[model samples]
Target: MKPIYSRIVATGGYLPERILSNRDLEQMVETSDAWIFARTGIRSRHIAAPGEKTVDMAEAAARQALADAGLNAADLDLIIVATTTPDQIFPSTACLLQARLGNRGAPAFDIQAVCTGFIYALATADRFIRSGGARHALVVGVESMSHIVDWTDRGTCILFGDGAGAVVLSAGDQPGIISTHIHADGAYADLLQVPGGETRIAMQGNAVFRVAVRTLGEIVQETLAANALTPAEIDWLVPHQANIRIIEATADKLGLPMERVVTTVEHHGNTSAASVPLALDEAARRGCFQPRQRLLLEAFGGGFTWGSALLRWG
Candidate 1:
């Protein structure tokens, strides 16, 4: 018997309509657009409206992905969501999404790895498809970061946004996902986390930056080595839309030019788990990927969590 691999059939993303610009933040806090832009390369990000929720964004993205793949909700063998801010505590966001899409009993659940979440979920879907546990899966990364951001805390507030991104995958003879690597260290969680009693994000920016640069660089090498490939072989770097500096360091490690990297931080900020998928969907919609081209996806987030996925475009 031949091995089965999971291939990405389609992708989708959704961002709230309300635009929150750095200038607006300046008014809300004591920060200027130039200062924020120089530090984070973020000009603006979308904020969900009062009535909007994480599941709503997830549904929109999931529906778009299903439509793009020409698949119905019933076709999915599994449903997985990677989200930090779910609509409810009891029901997993995946269940809520499955209900919205009218998909019944497909073993829906959620994964919480912060920014590395989508990568983890994608890897899980890949493994399930390979093991013959499922033929098709829907993986979604959605976050309502705006809901938890402390408007007064410019340090963390300017670094996050709310959005969702999704992908549809199917089992195939050839590999769509070449490899996936995920890791975490809870010891560094305090460096970047929303404290137990607080809803707002708190972070030691400098500390997090140092660790991110090192870990991300190490993973780039790990991914390439595992696949017996080199930095120059990667066609694109679809990274978590976090800080510009971290993205740059990863790009440098891959030796890929800026144009070859898919970056949405300037417009999307850090949508946590939604970052990579959102960037991927944006570039895919723009016809940026070509068949057989190699693409590298990576993310580093709170929990000191980080991961990478290598894939071929088809």
Candidate 2:
């Protein structure tokens, strides 16, 4: 039997203009640059200005992805946005983005898995492609964490930034996603979740940290085993850009070196659902990911959700 391929034709990302450096954060809250950098490795983050919403960012990223894929907005058959922070609580950010992009009548919706959003959405889109339900799909991961952040809390406030990333996935008959694994422990959901207004960003930092590291390691191992691929076969390990420590620990467990890890945490911070694709796009722009390269993507976040995917980079 021949294998079906869900190929990523192009990628794009958007970061807001308002740059908030750790030093800038010090003025807004009682946090030191040294502390933030030491703990999260976030030097600066993009803060969206007033009136710049999640849908706007998604639209911008989608436009670029469409252009890169050499397709028109009307060409997209599906739009899936992985987001926790939507422009409104009712209209899914995906739907809003579809309207903004001048795309009419296509199925559009938002998937909420906190930080694992992109992986969740990617997996869903891949399934749809494999089922022959859609030919061209736009999968986007975007967040406006700044809107929900409690600026007074130094711990959480310094750890997040705002941005969006997207990719154009098309149906093909080749090797694309080799394996995937997803898991969630709702019991620990309280460990890292918003508490009010659709849950404000409230979390038990220590607990969330422990689970993130441990689960991320387990998922990587599972992905490898499922595909019969070894750590040595991985060309890039793009873990969530939550913290430098988490990234280091996951790589250590997989026996992969730091240089092989694709990271943007130092500049992008934790853009929630946006981190994975943002890092992928960043690496792609740098020419770090080559065609047919083996890439392992993993993430863990709110909802206590975590997942991993093994892909043959295109």
Candidate 3:
């Protein structure tokens, strides 16, 4: 028999104080805000305070998610952090977050799937919950991409921002995750990837843009068909906040109108791993996601990783 898992009880997000607008980038580089906004739909993005690390932002978001779920750190059984830019090369940022959150016993680790991170982490948490290894899991998608971008390169620097978002998943027998689909085409890995220093970002913008649109549409159709659902049954469609064009293409291919797509790219920019969860939390807070609401979430990023999940919020 297939094991059953629970619903995500609560969601929360935390953004840094510094807001870097495309205008700000224009002053620093050769690009204009209009070009950036027209292409990516990103006007501004947040930057972590001096000395703030990925773990710090993850902890803050996790705390809020816990509070929203009416649970505490002591109650958590697992913590999974989805990030490409971790606080360090070792010790895993998820473990650091667990230590900081006052949860000494929970098993914590980090996953590096670039932008599709939250969906990857969510699936991991769901499996653990299903297998009866964990009762409550904290899944956080945090990134400090601002610290790593080559600010001198207008092509990449103007496209990313930093932030974190978290969700608290608890055990239940309701329809939470109906179906999930994950895909990767490593042949295009170099299309958009940070090449070195374990810090700096390296990317080929044009090529990655084309692949993202194609893969997102294909995987979304596969996910919907597997779940026995149709585009009309979806209450909301949330795509990775990489670029507005990417989101629009994905929505169009799925036959969903732009109005039905939840977007925060105009305000948050491409927050990488944090984008999806941050959008979800913001929508949940605004009362957009009702109980039993069907939401389809998708993301694509470095590693050429992409994933989709169909869920009915419990």
Candidate 4:
């Protein structure tokens, strides 16, 4: 019997219409455009309209992905949603999205790893495909970070936006996902956390930045070594859009020029789990990727989760 691999059939992304620029943040908080942009490399972020939910964004991205893949909802045998801000506590966001898409019987659930959620979900979906558990899988990373943001806090409010990114994975004979590496540590949880009942995100900016740069650098090295590939073989780096410094550090470590990195943090901010996929979809639409090209995706999130995935464009 031949081995099965999960290949990325198509990708889709969505961001809310509202633009919250750094100038806008200046009025909301005591931060200035120069200060915010200089530090985070973020110019603006999109805000969902009133009552726009995570499931709503997820549905839009999913439909776009399904359309791109030329696949119907019924074709999906598995659905996974990576979200930190789920629409509800009982019905998982994946289930709600499945219901909206009219997909029946496909096992749908959610994964919560904050920013690293999408990579984690993608790895799981890859496993299912490899294990002969599912042929078609829909993986989405969506977030409404504003839902829990402290509007008055200069620290967290300016750093997040709402968006969704989706991808359709199909079973293939060739190597789709070349390798995936994931890891977590709970000790640094307090460095970035939002209380269970409180609707606010509290993060130690400098501390988190330092740790993210270190861990992300290490993960990229591990990913490169795991696949026995050198930095020169990598075509692009799709990274978590948490901070510009962290992204730059990782790219520098890989010896890849900044031009080889797919960065959307300037406009998207950090959409938590949606960050990497959002960047990935944008680059793909721009024709930045070529078939058989090597693309590396990575993320570091709250829960102290960090991971990397290397894949060939399929």
Q: Estimate, for each residue in 30-120, the C-alpha lDDT of model 2 and write its tens digit.
A: 8889988998888999999999999889888888899999999899888999999998888889988888899998899899999999999
Evaluated against the true structure, the overall lDDT of model 4 is: 0.95
Give the Å shift of residue 120 in candidate 1.
0.7
**Candidate 3 residues 165-258, lDDT tens each?**
9999898776687777887778887777766645678888888888888889898889988977787888899788999999999888878888
Error of 1 at 80 (Å): 0.4
Ranking by lDDT: 4, 1, 2, 3
Using all chains and alpha carbons, the TM-scores for the candidates as numbered come to: 0.99, 0.97, 0.97, 0.99
Model 2, CA-based lDDT:
0.90
Taking every candidate in turn, the Cα RMSD to the unseen true structure, in Å, is 0.6, 1.2, 1.3, 0.6
Candidate 4 segments exceeding 4 Å error: none
Would you list the clashing residue pairs of candidate 3? 6-172
Instruction: Give me the displacement of residue 36 in model 3, in angstroms.
Output: 1.0
- Candidate 2 vs candidate 4: the lDDT winner is 4
Q: For residues 185-277, write the lDDT of model 1, one tens digit per residue.
A: 999978988888788888899999999999999999999999999888999999999999889988988889999999999999999999999
Candidate 4: give the clashing pairs.
none
